[model samples]
Target: MINGAHVILYSHDAEADRAFLRDVLGQPHVDAGGGWLIVKLPPAEIAVHPTDAAQAHELYFLCDDVEGTVRELTARGVEFTEPVTDAGWGLLTRLRLPGGGEVGLYEARHQRATDL
Candidate 1:
């Protein structure tokens, strides 16, 4: 049986990004070895979208309220690269990672599959 999933983010500055995930995001993690941290994520779901371009995978953090979550994260010193905007499926924005990359953040307007 499939137990769980692991998402990896390749970073130019791995340590700084790790610190952001551990300290800024306040994610619970355990050090594997040599300061490598494995983070515990909240409930997650996956979707398959048909595309004509090259195959790739993207990650997005789902929230209950985009504005509220943005405010909270801002207070914690997180930087957002974009303001939240309605995107039909959700209120979406991008948060900057310490390694100079951004990840999508959204509060979905559709039904959630987290209970599954």
Candidate 2:
């Protein structure tokens, strides 16, 4: 009986990144004692892709409309490092995080299992 997933983003400036997630992204979170904020993510799904390289995982935020989402986030002072590009499965872009890292944001054109 799986409950939910907890994702961690390692950052050089943990406090700044936490503020970005809490304030900038508007994610609902709770102080998990001692100021450890645990964020509640949106609906999520996983997929398996083949690769020859070492095993790695990625995190992406999904939206129904990439253009609209981009517009809104841009207004919120979020910087997008990449313009949206159609990747067959979705329209993808990278948003620059406050700690000098980037996260993936996409509007999926493919069917989502989360709707099931």
Highest lDDT model number: 1
lDDT of 2 by residue, 1-116 (tens): 99888888988887888889999999999998888888889999999999999999888999999999999999999999999999999999999889988889998888897898
TM-scores, all candidates, are 0.95, 0.95
lDDT (0-100) at residue 84 of candidate 1? 95
lDDT per model vs. reference? 0.92, 0.91
Model 1 residue 62 distance off true place after TM-score fit, in angstroms: 0.8
The candidate that achieves the highest TM-score relative to the unseen native structure: 2
Candidate 1 positional error at 29, Å: 0.4
The residue-level lDDT of candidate 2 at 32 comes to: 86
lDDT of 1 by residue, 4-116 (tens): 99999998998999999899888999999999999888899999999999999888999999999999999988999999999898899999999988899999999999966
